[model samples]
Target: MSAARLASASAATAHQRQWFADLHQEVAAGGDLALVNADAPQEIFRAMGIPYVVNQWWSSIVTAKRRAQDYLGLLRERGYPDDSEQYSSIPLASAFDPDPANAPWGGLPRPTIVLAETTGDASRKIFDIWDTQPGVSFYPLESAAENDVPARWWELMPRDWERAVGSDRLDLMTGELEGLIRFLEQTTGRVFSETRFAEVMDLVNEQQEWNRRTRDLIARARPCPLPVNDSIPSVMIPQWHRGTTWARDAARAFHDEVAERVSTGAAVCSEERARLMWIGRGLWFDLDFYRRFEQSHGAVFVWSMYLAIAADGYLRYGGDPLRALAARFAAFSDQLYTPPWSAEWYVKEARHHGVDGVVHLVSEDARGSYFTTRALEAAGIPVLELHADNVDARSADGDALTRTVGDWLDRRVRAGD
Candidate 1:
């Protein structure tokens, strides 16, 4: 590693340790919250002394097999050692195959959550799990896009709205939040006000804005090497989901850091690097394999899915919680689950950004199976369809994925030569 490469790695390691300790202390101090997405909430819990683990974060590490000093370090820092000899060839190899319908790992704390963006019957699936457990709770943020929700909430489309909100759970989904506000006010001697609500909204908006700026930074980090650039996703994912002003600051620092790194032409220690973009949900486990493509075929992964969403998906709700959240969820089906999403458009955009190939981490039981691989292939991009659950480790077909990826690389490597 060059001095710069080595410094980036060392700085990342130091940041990883200090940040984890900082967050753990934050979690040790608890606060009541209505969770959204199993991720953001669990991040709070993990920080607040609540037992939590990101299966996505964990799976990424185990697949990587990178030398982690401690297990908690792996949990806190997103990089895992990518030591799996089998996953050396794929674009972004995942070690996990998740069943999104349930917690990918057994023994997860009972969830309290709101589903904002996901594939298939995501709301129903998450609600069912929460319903079966006690002491764990949740509420729904209406399903819609951030920019479009205020116009059509309370008037959901018949084509998909009714199914998305059924009779049995609709009341629970819609009413629980209002109920919680009232309950907290009455029981805890807490005074609820529009001002307080606005405060929360402000916090959320700040998070969204920062996330957007982060993605914009990465997309600009074009042709940057993988390992050096990988820190962006690892840091941003944890920061956005968890509530930590310090973490947010760290993220901002990261954006400026990457911009500086890219401007300076710093990258992981590699000579020939093929830049690729990852689409769809992150393959929680196979993160290392993704990095290996940089070394194996000289291909550097430039992007993953959620980092971009945080940048683009969050809405600035201002003072209207329902309208803002509803807007975020409104497009979930379209962008991820439902059809008519421009897979072709995104792939073309990636190609324009100079992507050499694409990887779609297909999870088990995720409903949108109709989105074909040909969209990117048609755009003159080689698509690698790796079968793996994005969350759960048990479902991953490591051997099959390894073999298929090897085959894909054989073609790409030979063609490049």
Candidate 2:
């Protein structure tokens, strides 16, 4: 039997559905909306009262609804590469979904403006396509390279952000943020307020702090009180709404729920024998896969980047809220996907969670997966690498992947036992 779902996770999912429905209605009634990348500075939009939808979050919804292929095919029919950066490109293709009524969520309303950071060639090309649409204007930000490599970034990011992100990099991002503010002000005819932005920043920090507390609670709980499937929605839905009081309270409530579960010795798998860490984006198409091993091999996936990154990646505590916000995104991808930084954090989390093994789903678009595997192995934690797209399900064979993991667990993870 599957473990009972967390009440917090259920509530978060319900709230997201209602929120999206309201956004859809508002857009239908002639309200403007922004479609932004996951790494874009969303708090600015929040403070300005501009309703925005994250490209990645929407892509996940499309994938979950099994409409990813239909949209991706729309790209191929138009001579666009169907396989490149599917996570970022899927939603763009959905715009051409011949029948809007058949599209997921009644189709993402035609965005008035689209925002993205030019993180790579394919993503730039994808967002550029959005700009060509009649009513959509695209604004791209330059992704600055990380000049200074820091160690234990999570330790320094909250307060010592200047050192965590470097002064020069922060300057570039801060300037770009100012330009973005100007563009929004001109486009929406609403003045930007520094005081309001600072308040939004504070709420985001509070939300992340509660996430940190919950992560620590889960890490120290031996039996793993909450499943990774449950934790993903409970933490990430609120994360998308990071600058709101409701988001902050939702995070705290999740923490308290986990605390209660841990105190009561609640376990996702009562026969839990091996703890595993999932080291990539979620398999939105097959979340049930996380639970498949629990019944057969007694392996419960205890960690994912969703809650862990929220805990460690989003906090910035300095006087200048704009620069602090800039610091948050300046090297955001670097700290998560680059060597040394990602490798170090994965090892730290593996050790802290006491994971017996790791199932690292290495997406084609992500970097440094091999380094992460090497680091975990060096730390004496076995890793099973599975190459698959987290958002695109067309190429993945669920049965084959399951058998591969089952065999690996028997040979490598549970071998000594």
Candidate 3:
């Protein structure tokens, strides 16, 4: 490419990164809230009138592909890409910036409690000070907590502001459904009946069916034997935030659409961008730090985090209400925790997704990361570990991360030496 054109491209990438930086700063105004997932809605929070974002379908899709382009294409096709001043990223998908200080959208939230699939010890420390403290958070489907649930049930159980988080402990459950029904009915003044119950049952069933179908896609999602950048978003978005029906449908929708996009020959990315997969929470403080590697090394990140769950996880919930709920949680723990299983599962996913290498983020509050990291290395896939918070943007040193990632990619993906 000519120097002028190269300079122009650099300028564009810089503009995009700056826009994201502004978006991050602008959104921080809202404060925070308790984050939840499909299987574990915060009944108490809802009851107490605290708001939370369910990350069911969204989480799955982001992890589906091996590149950032895959995600970007999925969004553009879906008509939700970044434009002028708008962002279609997960955090802002459901809501937007106004004056985040007063609302939950733009600004973070007070007590931004989040529901993760499974958090490791270090990751937990990261979550405590970051995801939970300001707010209380838990994993609705944290099946590992099963032995204790019957005794404790799910409650705020505040020890210190960040105690539970520091220990990487998660408050997981399907939520207090029995109590939630009463709360919602009272709050919305809408009467729920067997018919309504059945509707919910139907919703859950649709979710599971979609999940079954999407996994079929995940198995074959990597057509290139090397995943493309545009594919990850469509796969992850829907599955990460599955509780809401709309979230699930959108993810599944992105998959078929992306395939057609390929068939129709849409530009996958501007320069055949060599892609990479990020296997961990997003570094909230340094999204650009994450992307800066592109400019420093001429690589366009095609994928990272959330979006695939939207595509697949949505399928496990749709049958017999209680039965579907149990099945979904059963499926989550069946895969996420328990080292041998989780590590093996991701290996298959990595091979199937076809990435050149893997970058795993190990947080202070996160547990079980070593197992996953080890498994990938044993499988012969190049992997890099970066320690930082996925949410606490405040914790990351963008310049340092950028340098490390640039060197890794130069040798691993670009030079292929």
Model 2: weakest 10-residue lDDT segment is 1-10
Candidate 2 vs candidate 3, lDDT winner? 2
Better of 1 and 2 by TM-score: 2
Cα lDDT for residue 323, candidate 1? 39
Instruction: Compute each candidate's TM-score over C-alphas.
Output: 0.64, 0.98, 0.56
Error of model 3, residue 342, in angstroms: 1.9
Span of ten consecutive residues with least summed lDDT in model 1: 88-97
Predicted candidate 2 versus true structure: per-residue lDDT over 368-391, tens digit per residue: 898999999999999999999987
Ranking by TM-score: 2, 1, 3
Model 2 score (lDDT):
0.90
Off by over 4 Å in 1: 1-129, 132-134, 138-180, 183-192, 225-229, 232-244, 317-322, 342-345, 397-400, 412-416
Q: Highest lDDT: which candidate?
A: 2
Clashes of each: 35, 0, 103
Query: For residues 1-417, what per-residue lDDT tens digits would candidate 3 score against the true structure?
Result: 111112222333344345335545543665334556444533233334344544533322222222223433443554653221111133332232334343222233333445444333433332343333323433322435332221111111111212211222222232434444454455435454645455544554455455445444434432321132333333333333334455446544554554454454443233434546577655443444544554455454334434333333323323335333333344344244446545765676666556677888876545578998888889887888997755433345767777788788887767754
**Residue 101 lDDT in model 2?**
71
TM-score of 2: 0.98
lDDT of 1 by residue, 286-400 (tens): 5556656555676666766555555544433432453343333445444444333436335534754577777666654443444546666666777787666554444566667
